[model samples]
Target: MSYVDGFLLPVPKKNLAAYKKMAAKAGKIWREHGALDYRECAGDDLKTAFGLPYPKLMKLKKGEVPVFSWIMFKSRKHRDTVNAKVMKDPRIQAMCPDPKQMPFDVKRMCYGGFKTLVKA
Candidate 1:
């Protein structure tokens, strides 16, 4: 099984492009630091008939949408190692010198590390 770090957040529609640009750079940094895979996806069809929809779950405001992202690694230990290097990376520091400057609210972002339970 592999390890994964997942993230879910709300980003303003007007900031989506900026968010995508930032994510692309960040993904490259993660991959360069040994992440097996990295992906960032924006929500498209959020309206649903059943269960809690992302817009509701995230309490999305006008012109805001949910974004989901994840990074894969060989294992939890590997994830930790790669992330440590990524944190120390100068590019990352320059990209996000102040969390408050991010396109979305960092405080509203949800993140968790998971152990893969099943794979086909």
Candidate 2:
């Protein structure tokens, strides 16, 4: 079974373009480094439900929304290897060229690595 890594964060409206550019580069890097798939989805359709662990209601600014992304790998070992390379890649390093350009709050970001429990 494949392994999946998930991430969720809030992105500033003014930084959406910058975030997209960085995400594109990151997706490519993940693929090249051995990820089966790398996908980023702007959080538009998220809805609240009882007892959900994720934020039921995102506290958005005047024009901001949450963002979510995931990367699929053949297994945990493959994910580890790919992540290592991606982290070391110059392209990934350049994504955050300046502190002010970072789109999301790194401290508030949520991430987890999961083992596939069921698949179609």
Using TM-score, give the best candidate's number. 1
- Give residue 99's lDDT in candidate 2 (0 to 100): 60
lDDT for 86 in candidate 2 is 88
Task: Give the Å shift of residue 72 in candidate 1.
Answer: 0.5
Model 1 global lDDT (CA atoms, 0 to 1): 0.96
Off by over 4 Å in 1: none
Q: lDDT per residue, candidate 1, 4-67, as tens digits?
A: 9999999999999999999999999999999999999999987799999998998888999899
TM-scores for all candidates: the values are 0.98, 0.85
Q: What ranges in model 2 sit over 4 Å off? A: 47-62, 97-100
